[model samples]
Target: MDQVALLQISSALLLNVGFIWLVGSWFARRWLGSSGVKRNDVEPALRKLDLVAAGVSAVASVVALYAATAVMGGISLQEAGPMFWMMLSTTHYGHIGCLTILAMMILFAIRVRGGTSGASDTASLLTIVAFAITRASMGHAGENGILSVSLAAEVVHFFSIGLWTGAVIVSAYFVLTPQRVATLALAVTDRYLNVMSRGVMLAVILIIGTGLYNAWHRIGTVEQLTRSSYGLTLLVKIALVACAIGLGGYNKFFGLPAAGRSARGVAVVRRVLQIESVLLLGALAAAAILTSQQPPTAI
Candidate 1:
């Protein structure tokens, strides 16, 4: 991919980390709220995750703002600042996105300082959803004739991906840390696995359905699959997705039930989750490449 493509892709992946943080933190608190574990235990874990997530989100917003200008203006990133400022001051979409970023920064501050409430969390969630929606509206989803339907499908796809990846991220934090032994009690971990199993299954279905719907319209025909770069990259992405799904299915069916039975078992599951994350990252990169290239119909 070219530098601009790389910037867009990187910005997208980085942006995802923000959404994932919200999902992860929310789940950790909600799931453990009723457990015997002290609320102190659960809340602290979330805040720790929040500190890292806030930093990531802040950096990503800055990068995306710069990258958006570069991509749209077809200018070197360093030269895109003036254009970025102009859009921030003039365009509806640009201003809205910037405002969301500003709000999220404030929310992140409250989160890090341990002052976040359900209301703040809800606001942040909505802001991220808005951000994701704006992204969809400006991209391939809104390009075709099915603007309304495509936009809805894109929302489902992005949120589903965010939810699934977010849970995995939290799991990684708890499982891979040196303090795993104390991070969450065994019962709590088991409950988390149970919830994740159901949540991820639903997300997978949504992601697959919306992905195919979008692709059918964009790819247009089987002949184009072999004739265009977009189609080829999409095929590769599909393979990567299948790999990720297979790994997740294995974890859900075979590994999860066995998790927390022993320290060794938990460690094994942790390793599997980390690998699944890597597979997803590969898929995300392929998706970015596919997005940057023209669709087969256009090609």
Candidate 2:
């Protein structure tokens, strides 16, 4: 694919990831919070958020599907369209299974907030496992061990993104809102900040480590980092990741301390989170470009 097309694909993938984060965070908060909202209240908000996420996901998925089809469709049509359908079938099921896990996580939050659940958390986890295996079947995991490692890294990265970002959003909302039914709000926020900070650190490490491994494996040489298409894409992604880390460092050292006392701290945290989100999106866009490029396999 051309650069423009590659960027488009990457942007779409980022959107997919972002939308999933949104669903797992903002949507979950609005629906599952212990804010005296009723079941009636819950359904409406959940439906609205789910609809938006679904729409965005569908668009991204269709574009990705079309692109994948464009490449594989011709070959499959000539050779074995049935096999193509079968692969798509498995992949589609995995997508659904992942989404279902997200939905269950939302419900889990609701139950944790003192609501009840007829669904099982174990089911959600199993679905995630199945989805992971299905995805592995498609990538380098199917062909080599390295792809599975990359996929595992991606899972950690994506889940951490969801947790840290979601916690940031939820804490900010709690702080800004006028409701004061619980004395534990501040305490909860503090504890959450600590947990999220730790999680974000782990995520940063995972992203960097796994990303480097994938790049080294694909590029295969020090010189290729600057000489190849994959290398250039890696450069852009690395820059974005560094910027994100800088913003995170600012939040951790300077901003988080003030986060408790002054409105300025809260504002700083919010702004930093937004910037981090943008950087994450940029990283994803670069990834999209990278996925479509020819790796320096022999070099």
Candidate 3:
């Protein structure tokens, strides 16, 4: 493949991997919430789900690392053997290693709490760290600056977005439900949702800021934005994000507040959740396209 084609293909794969990770995370959280286990019985279920999610995450990390090595670093697929193998093995093991440690923590927590593991919190923390580091290793934004602090900030920017997106999916799974959950579940979900909302708000702002900075650094002019492949792909990504944001706003302003008020309210929440999921998927698709585009080397 030519450089441009290779760049696009690799990025597309990485974006797909990201989408998979997001879905897996959301699904695991959902399963944990619906396990029908008591607080005392929740540890085992949470541990199992965490392990599953870790496996999914491992695959995603491998795809992301390979895409990074091939596209951003200019290594052909045929020449990517050592780099791909090393990065994949290292990152996968690292994720599994984190899961092992989290499992131990959950066991200890279970012994102390007598039923609950708090495994979900551990999974969240680990995923945030893993994604931030992996993104730093792979993205151009991270390759900027002499100190890699800019890279760290880019990772933070990516992580913040992931947390917001992941949290929304998680909240849709556990909170804003149509079914009758226990009072405790309701309270847990309520607190989580509140926290998630604030986090998402912050994440949106950061994404906008970082995105504008990156675009300015790369595109340099309005004409370049329209004329360049990278710029065009970015435009598509922004459009998708805008649509998703609109759906999110509807969920927040209309669906969430009215949740549980009546049968119609419950129905509305469910519909909006479904719509949000679709929009999120669309955004992911656009992200895949964006990843494949070559970085504008010159205006």
Clash statistics: count for each candidate: 0, 0, 2
Pairwise lDDT winner, candidates 2 and 3? 3
Q: Tens digits of per-residue lDDT for model 3 on 35-101? A: 4324433444444544444444445444444555565457776676667656545664334434433
Model 2 residue 48 CA deviation (Å) reads: 4.0
Candidate lDDT values, in order: 0.72, 0.54, 0.55
lDDT of 3: 0.55
Lowest-lDDT window of 10 residues in candidate 2?
A: 175-184
> Candidate 1: which stretches are off by over 4 Å?
34-36, 143-147, 175-178, 182-184
Candidate 2 lDDT score at position 45: 43
Error of 2 at 249 (Å): 0.9
Note the residue pairs that clash in candidate 2: none
Alpha-carbon shift of residue 59 in model 2 (angstroms): 4.7
For model 2, the superposed segments whose C-alpha errors exceed 4 Å read 1-15, 18-47, 73-133, 145-188
